[model samples]
Target: MAEVVTSGAVARTVEDLSGPRGLPVVGNLPALVRGGRPHRTLEEWCDRFGPTFRMSMGRTPAVVTADPAVIARIHRQRPDDFQRSAHVSGVIDELGGHGVFTAEGDEWRRLRKMATQALNMAYLRQYFSTITLVTDRLKRRWDAAAESGRAVDVLDDLMRYTLDVTSGLAMGHDLNSLEQTGDGLHRRLPLLFPEIGRRINAPVPYRRRVRLPRDRRLDATVREIDALVRDRFAEAARRMEGGGEPANFLEALVAPLEGESPITHDEVFGNVLTMLLAGEDTTSSTAAWAVHYLAGHPEAQRRVRAEADEVLGEHAFPPDPAAVGRMKYAEAVVTEAQRLRPVAPYIATQPLHDVTFETEQGPLLVEKGTPIFSLHAYGARRDTVRFPDPEAFRPERWLEGALPPESLPFAPFGGGPRFCPGRNLAVVEATIVVATACRGFDLEPDHSAGPVGERASFTAFPVNLRVRLSARR
Candidate 1:
């Protein structure tokens, strides 16, 4: 059995490590770009080459580790020993989203606390009503679909619900994307994560050299969203000046936008864009996947629905923030979904200096500036030793006292100082959506739509996961 890689041991350079063969110059770039499910490819490589092995992209040194312990160590290193890979940072910056997700060093330090606090549990409590409102809106729409005997476009509708909640709660802007006929932002959000992955992996950034029509369209959408966010900031500034208590996230984020505020317009605006893009896609997909699992596991669906009924009484959505927390079974469903079908299946990190990682396999020295791609879902999905019947969707595995006392391999939210700032909000938001779906409807797999499988843009989502939503017996 392979062991988690640790630090301090006799050293062997990456050149001395093992990996799949590559073309003279292109190396593994081809496999990454054209491969089926790049995350799964990395996981396969980890299984083949042991933990902490080397690969390259266009002749540039890259590393991959499937060991959860090494991934946790990499996370703890943070902006010091490692940081978000430059490729990812560049792509985010290109999209005009350079907030906590893309910030580094002093800038990261400055933005992290603010962004984290804005979505913390307390903030969720403050915004829970908005979530509940959006939840009801989604239920109303699903009710219409159920009444008509239609297969719900589960992923698309969930995305709209999350966007509606995020817009209302974060900026006091009623995007109401769920109800919007335009569907402009709705079209744009799904384009981003895939593009982020493409640009990051493309050996030469071919789109940048010769922009395609799709690229131009993406640029237009990004510009539109940016302008919309700026307008919201201006609106929030105006409201705060009128002695209105900070009503939404934007209002609370900016303090007296008139003079000498600690945060910059760009930082605040970037974070807003980040939240808008990240908030809708990740949680919605997570909830959608939870529904996907529930559709296949009727017993699990029953348990989740029973739990939601107990917590919610007769409410269509979580009645209060406290109630959201009390839906432990529903939360576990999301956790298990994250384990089996993590929205972020993998994360990219890099070594800031030459470093030695001691694996039970052995010690390997890695050089500075090497891009380290850690396939986090490998442990959650592949480690049968850690999770018996690893491929199974068992929400009970996440409940209190279900596992032994050891560091969890789950990295759905990333980990350490730079762990996802919006994690609490995402989980709470996803839990509410999942619980409501279970409580209000019975979901059955829409086999007529075709097979459902994992697709990765950046966050992995179930492709063709439409479901039949019917009122319960």
Candidate 2:
């Protein structure tokens, strides 16, 4: 029997560790790319290999885990040992330093508080109508494309909708990319992140060694976005100068904090970009999968349709928060879709201090500076300890309180103090999108485009999601 080892126990040998041999500088770059469906492949390796595994990515030694008890120890019990991974923080620093997603210790606390205040349930409820408006707009576009007998890229449309919502409600700028034509700032948003994401995920030499023509274009687009953000921040500052209390997250963040560092102007710009990048696609992709699944499974579609009918009536746009809240199956569909295709698959954390933790298999040593990866997707769906028949896309699992609290089997939004602040917002947004889309039309799975492939980057987006949306009677 596997010993349930804790921090006090002797540091036992780590069991699951099967990685490819590598050179010093370019450690596993070739391997990481070669192994497509990298998440699932890594999971298979862990299953064959046990608990804690070691892998090297271009000389960076990484420790990966899928064990529930071990994940709980790092995220919950001995959380101090697990700080944001340096690699991850470096990118965040470049992108948006000292914000809720990147800041550590007191700085992290301050940003988290501000973000929590701004992104509270009340604010999210207020934005519910905006989310519905975007969803309806997207459906109309899709319906038009379908009626024209044209193949639509569901991924692109979803991106536009979420980008529009995030920019308007959170950033206080009505980019209006959801309805407008032209390859304006909004069209550039999706392209900007992926190119930067590719550069960040690449090894230093590899990232620097190769500079494509597209890099210049990507940089130019980024500059445009920065210019826009700076203008907004300046306008906000001017309004504050006029003695009027400013509104929206952009304005609120510029105000002073009690005894902590107020979010700096640089940090504000970075976080605005971060919010656009981090918050949008994850929600959109999950919503896309939910719609995909609900459409194929007519029974599930009926449930969502019933919930939307009860809550939203025959209206195209959700008029109120009460309508958003009455979406039980819609909520369940989002939950199950996340379980099936989580946007942020694996979250990496590095320990601040030396610590030890327990695992179902045995005890393990977490050195002071070791990088630890809490593979949320693997844990959420694979851990049978939490869900029965883990692979099935059954929203019913969330129906009768089937999930446990705080374990590997249950970390879609993560656990403990570092849990995602935007979880509720994501859920509500997803619910509105799924329910409203269901109400507007029926999604039929088009097998011709092939299965959805998980595109890895800073976040994962479902690729090749070619589904046909037909008008509902």
Candidate 3:
């Protein structure tokens, strides 16, 4: 456990940092691509080449670090010593998602303030029923599947459930994807994240030159999303004109703040898009991963079920925040799931200035404008000293207070100034869903449901993780 040494100059430049040797001009791009999930490969590399080292994707030279101290410092020094990767921001902006997540400098500050207010716990408390309503909808949907012997596509359906929750809370409307199916925003959203990842890792922006079908579909999805957001904004505006208070997130964005001019419609839309993007895949993926682990570890699942039954009593869902708060075991399971299988496994950032980043290995000089991958997932999970059995899915460990002081090194929402705004909403959504599912039904892993695989896009989601829901008899 080494601290960041900024005072003294212990030196080793990017040129001096050791990493895997690459062939010709392509560099380590093929190894990364062939490695399947980039996060896993990055972790493997971290094990091989100390904590901090260099790796290139084609001609792009980037530094990768799984050191918690280095990663925390990187996140805290945002828009100063470091910032979100320019290439990532450009990709997000081009895809119509330039909001708090991608905005830099003063723009980021402004958006962060508005975004923070909208996601405050007070708002989430007001919207507690929305979480319950969405959770119930999911329960009913799964009930139908269980009764009819239809296998549940846990990740796909969880996306719909999360979208419903976010839409009700953020847009002040019910965009239900649970009952309705095929070619809706829920279906469109899962595609958007993976595409963003593909573009980010691409050596050449070849899709721009020769449009693939996937690219065209992404274009259509963005257009539809833009239209949907505008419609919601118009409704919020109409409500404001009628002298109604700012009820939901969209209204919060549209309603003027003191000493500030009204935000542009584009900005409003961008922020709304950011909320949906932040909420959808991240929560759904985490909840899905929890389900995967629970199915395999029946004792943990049973404990979660018992806790949910006790906390929820006769109700179908947790009555309030207090009630959900009482279900310690279930929440522990969700927290463990987050630690083991984080959605955004690594953060993509760039240095704003030349600085010495101290790792357990040693102090290394990182140049200005260098792309950085702070593998926070690897930091928390891979540290055998902190987490003895890093690979095991042991929810009870979380119950036993196994994590030591300052858990931000592996916190799913991240740490420092840019911590996730939608974290409260995401955790509640996941916790409620996990509770509801385990309380009423049994998640039986299907033997014939193809190979269980994983794909790392912007968020890592379970692939072909088909689990059948059986009525708890």
Report lDDT per candidate. Answer: 0.79, 0.71, 0.82
TM-score for each of the candidates: 0.93, 0.90, 0.95
Residue pairs with backbone atoms closer than 3 Å in model 2 (clashes): 16-49, 16-50, 27-58, 81-351
**Higher TM-score: candidate 1 or 3?**
3
Off by over 4 Å in 3: 1-10, 402-408
After superposition, the stretches of candidate 2 with alpha carbons farther than 4 Å from their true spots are 1-9, 13-25, 77-79, 96-98, 206-211, 238-246, 260-262, 405-407
Candidate 3 residue lDDT tens string, 299-397:
887888888887777888887887887888887788888888888888889888888877776677787888888888776676787777888887777
Where does candidate 2 have its weakest 10-residue lDDT segment? Answer: 11-20
In model 3, where is the ten-residue run with the lowest total lDDT? 1-10
Per residue, candidate 1 scores C-alpha lDDT tens digits across 187-299 of 67667777777777667878767989988988988888777778888998898888855767788777833333467777777887778777877888999999999999899
lDDT of 2 by residue, 1-473 (tens): 22435655655433234455667788756566553455665666577655567777776677778776777766674335567877777765654433677777766767778777767777776666667677767778977976876665667777887888888666678777767888788887787556655665666635346657886676677677778888888887778777764466687777766876566667787777767776787878878788777767988887888878887766766676666666878888898888888777677888787555666555665666777777766866666767778888888888778575335555777778888777777777788778766787777777677886677666777778777777786
Best by TM-score: 3
Q: In candidate 1, which residue ranges exceed 4 Å CA deviation?
A: 1-9, 256-261, 404-407
Please report the candidate that would top lDDT against the real structure: 3
How big is the positional error of residue 436 in model 2, measured in Å on the Cα after superposition?
Answer: 1.5
Candidate 2 scores a C-alpha RMSD against the true structure in Å of 3.3
